[model samples]
Target chain A: MKKVIVHVTLKEGVLDPQGQTIETSLHSLGFTEVEEVRTGKTIELLLDNHDNVEARVQDMCTKLLANPVIEDYRVNVEEAVQS
Target chain B: MKKVIVHVTLKEGVLDPQGQTIETSLHSLGFTEVEEVRTGKTIELLLDNHDNVEARVQDMCTKLLANPVIEDYRVNVEEAVQS
Candidate 1:
C-alpha cells in the first residue's frame, strides 16, 4: 500500500486567526519566546497503489479538504511496508 | 528567517475519526472513489535563525503541537526567499 501525507496551510501572506489564538494561549501558559504561529491541517491517505494518487489527492484537497483560494497543500508519498 | 512546517498525524495503525467524517462527507457530496481518509494537523513557524531551532520546534511539537503517545510528527525546514 502507498501512504500519502497531505499538509494544508493558509498561504504565507494570509492571516491566521486560529494560530494567533494559540500563540496568545501559549504566552499565557508561560511560553514567551514564540514569535508567530500558523496552524493548518494534516491528512493521510492509504491507497492500494501510488500511481496517479497525487492527482486524486490534489483533487480531494481542492474539492473538500481545503479552501483553495486562501490555502495551499503539499503532498508527500511513502511506500507502506507489506506484512 | 527559518520557516518550519510541522505535520502531526495519528500513528500508523491508529484509527482516525475525523478522516472518516471527511470521507463520508465527501461521498455525500458526490465523491465516490475515496477509499480511506485520516486527518491531523499542520503548524508553520517563522524563526529568525535555524540554529537550535529544531530542538525548540520539536519541543514545541511535544509540548503543544501534538499528543505524544497517539500522534507522530515530521518537520520540514525551508529558507524563506527574502524579497
Candidate 2:
C-alpha cells in the first residue's frame, strides 16, 4: 500500500479572510510576530497499487480536493510501510 | 519573517466521515485504488519573529488549531524568505 499526501494551499494574490482573522487574533493576544496567515487543507489516503501514484493523486486534487481557480496543490506519495 | 505550518490530523481510531465520503466518491468514480482517506487542516502563518517559533506554533495548535482530544498536530516553521 502507499500513502498519498495532498497539500492544498491558496494561490498567490488570493484573499484569505480566515488567515487575516488569525493574524488579528494573534496580534491581539500579544503575538505581534506575525505578518500574515493562510489556511489550507491536507488530504491523506492509503491506497493499493496504482499505475502512477503521483498522477492519479494529482487528478484527484484537480477533480475534487482543491479549487484550481484559487488554490494550488502538491502531492506526495510514500510507501505505507506497514510493519 | 517565518512561515509556520501546522498540520492537524485526526487521532487513530477517530472516525473521519468526510474522508470516508471522499473515498467512496473516488471509488465510485472508477478510481478504486484508494482504501482509506483522512482529511486534515493545514494552517500557514507568516510571522515576524517569535523567540522560539516551533514552540509558539505548537502552542497555537493546542490552543486553537487542533483538538487534543481527537486530533494530533505537527508544526513546521521556516524562514519567510521575502525576496
Candidate 3:
C-alpha cells in the first residue's frame, strides 16, 4: 500500500488562538524560550495502489483536507512499503 | 530561533471517527482506492534558543499536545536557522 502524510498549517497572517494559549501555558510551565507556536493537523492515508498518487493526494488536500485561503499543506509520500 | 515539528498520531486500534469520515468522503469524491485514513495533529513551535530543546518539546508533547496513553508523538528539531 501507499502511505501519504500531509501536514496542514495555517497561513502566515492567520490568528491562532489555540497556539497562543499553548505558548502562554508553556511559559507558565517554565519553558520560557518560545517565540511563537503554530498548531496544525497531520493526516495519514493508506491507499490501494493507483497511478499518479501524489497528484491525486494533492487534489484531496486542495479539495477537502485544507482550506486554501487560510492554510497550506505539504505532502510526503511513503512509496509502497511492506505492511 | 528554532523550529520543532511535533507529529501526534493515535495509537493503533484507537477509534478515529474523523478519519473514517474523511475516508468515506474521499471515496465519494471519486478516489475510492483508499484503504485506511488516520488523522492527527502537528504542532510547530518557533522557539528561542535554549539547551536541550528536543527533550523540552517532547515534554510539551506528552504534557499538552498529545495524550500519552492513546497517542504516540515524534519530534523533529530544526536547529537554529537565520530567520
Candidate 4:
C-alpha cells in the first residue's frame, strides 16, 4: 500500500483569523514566547498499489483537498509496510 | 528563533466522518484505488529562543493544540536559520 500525506496551508499574505486566535490564546495561556502560529490541514490516505500515485494524489489535492487560490499544498507519498 | 510543528491526529479507531466523505469523493472523482483516508491538523509556530522549547511546545499541545482524550500529537522542533 501507499501512504500519502497532503499538507494544505494558507498562502502567505492571506489573513488567517483562526491562527491569530490561537496565537492570542497561547499568549493568554502563558506561552508568551510564541511569536506566530499558523494552522493547516493534514490529509493522510492509504491507497492500493498503483503507478503514478504521486501524480494522482496531487490531482486529488488540486481537485478537492485544497483551494488553489488561497492555499498551497505539498504531497508526500511513502510506501506502507505490509502487515 | 525556533520553529515548532505540531501534528494532531485523531486516535486510532476514532470515527472520522470527514475522512470518509473525502474518500468517497475521491472515488467518485475516479481515484478508486484510495482505500482509507484520515484527516488531522498541522500547527506551525514561530517562537523566540527559549529554554526547553520542546517541553514548552508539548505543554501548548496539551493545554490547547490537541485534545488529549481523543487525539495524539507529535512535535518537531527546528532551529530557524538566520536569514
Candidate 5:
C-alpha cells in the first residue's frame, strides 16, 4: 500500500476564521508568540496501486476533501516501503 | 515571500486518539461513512528570502508546529512568484 497525503488550506488571499480561533485558543493557553496561524486539513489514504495516483487523489480532493470556494489542495504520493 | 507548509499527522504505527475523536464528531454531525477521520495541522509562513528555507521551517515544525511524541511532519517550500 502507498500513502496518498492531501493538504487542504485557505487560498493565499482568503481569510481564515478557523485559524483565527486556533490562534486565540493557543494564546489563551499561553502560546503568545505564535504570531500568525492558519488552519488546514491533512488526509492520508493507503491505496494498493500507484497508477494514476495523483489524478485519482486530486479528484478525491476536489470532490470531497476541500471546499473549492475558499480552499486549495496539494497532493503527495509516497510508497509504503516497509510492513 | 516563500510559503513554508508543514504537515503534521500521527505516525503510521501509533494510535490516533485525536483522529478517533474527530471521526466520532463527524458521525455526530450526521456524516457516517466518513470512517477514518485523522486530523493534522498545516501552517503557512511568508518569508522574503529563500536561503535555508527548508532548515528554518523544519525548526519551526519541531519547535512548535507539531507534537513529536505522536506526530510526524513534512515541509514544502514554495516561492511566492508574484504579487
Candidate 6:
C-alpha cells in the first residue's frame, strides 16, 4: 500500500482569521513570543499499491481535496509501513 | 527565529467522519484504490528566537493547539529561513 499525505494551506496574503485568532489567544496565554500562525489541513490516505499512485493522488487533490483558487496543496507519497 | 509546525491528529481508534466522507467521495470519483482516510490539523507558527522554544511550542500544543484526550500532536521546530 502507498501512504499519501496531502497538506492544504491557504495562499500567502490570504486573510486567515482562524490563525489570527489563535495568535491572539496564544499571546493572551502568555506565549508572546509567537509572531504568526497559519493553519492548514492534513489528510492521510492509505491506498492499494498501484502504478502512478502519485499522479492519481495529485488528481484527487485537484478534484476534491483542495480548493485551488485560494489554497495550495502538496502531496507526499510513501511506502505504507505495515503494522 | 523558529518555524514550528504542529500536526494534530485524532488518536488511533477514534472515528473520523470527515475522513470517511472523503474516502467515499474519492471512490465515487473513481479513485477506487483508496482504502482508508484520516484527517488532521496542521498549524504553522513563526516565533521569535528564544531559549527553550521547543518546550514552549509543546506547551502551546497542550494548552491550545491540541486536545490531549482524543488527539496527539507532534512538533517540528526548524530554523526560519529568511526571505
Ten residues in a row with the worst lDDT in model 4 chain A? A74-83
| Candidate lDDT (C-alpha), each | 0.78, 0.85, 0.90, 0.93, 0.67, 0.94
Between candidates 1 and 2, the DockQ winner: 2
Error of 4 at A32 (Å): 0.8
Pick out the ten consecutive residues of candidate 1 chain A with the lowest summed lDDT: A42-51
**Predicted candidate 5 versus true structure: per-residue lDDT over B44-82, tens digit per residue:** 655555467687667666766778987899988776644
Better of 3 and 4 by DockQ: 4
Tens digit of per-residue lDDT, candidate 2, span B6-55: 88899999999999999999988778888899999888888776688888
Docking class of 6: high
Better of 1 and 5 by lDDT: 1
Best by lDDT: 6
The digit string of per-residue lDDT tens for model 4 on B4-39 reads: 999999999999999999999999999999999999
The sequence of per-residue lDDT tens digits that candidate 3 reaches over residues B13-73 is 9999999999999999999988899999978899888888998898888778789999999
**For candidate 5, what is the total of clashing residue pairs?**
0
The ten-residue window of minimal lDDT in model 6 chain A covers A74-83
Query: What DockQ does each listed candidate score?
Result: 0.51, 0.80, 0.84, 0.91, 0.23, 0.91
Worst 10 residues of 2 chain B by lDDT: B74-83
Q: Per-candidate TM vs. native?
A: 0.76, 0.91, 0.93, 0.96, 0.57, 0.96
lDDT by residue (tens digit), candidate 4, A11-82: 999988999999999999999999999999999999998888999998998899999999999998876746
Task: Report the lDDT tens digits of candidate 2 across residue range A1-83.
Answer: 88989988999999999888887887887777777788988899898877788888888888888899999989988776472
Query: Between prediction 2 and prediction 4, which has the larger TM-score?
Result: 4
Model 3 chain B: worst 10 consecutive residues (lDDT sum): B74-83
CA shift of B77, model 3, Å: 0.9
Q: Report the lDDT tens digits of candidate 6 across residue range A1-83.
A: 88899999999999999999999999999999988999999999999887899999999999999999999999999777573
Model 5, residue pairs in steric clash = none
Lowest-scoring 10 consecutive residues by lDDT in candidate 4 chain B?
B74-83
Give stretches of model 6 more than 4 Å off. none
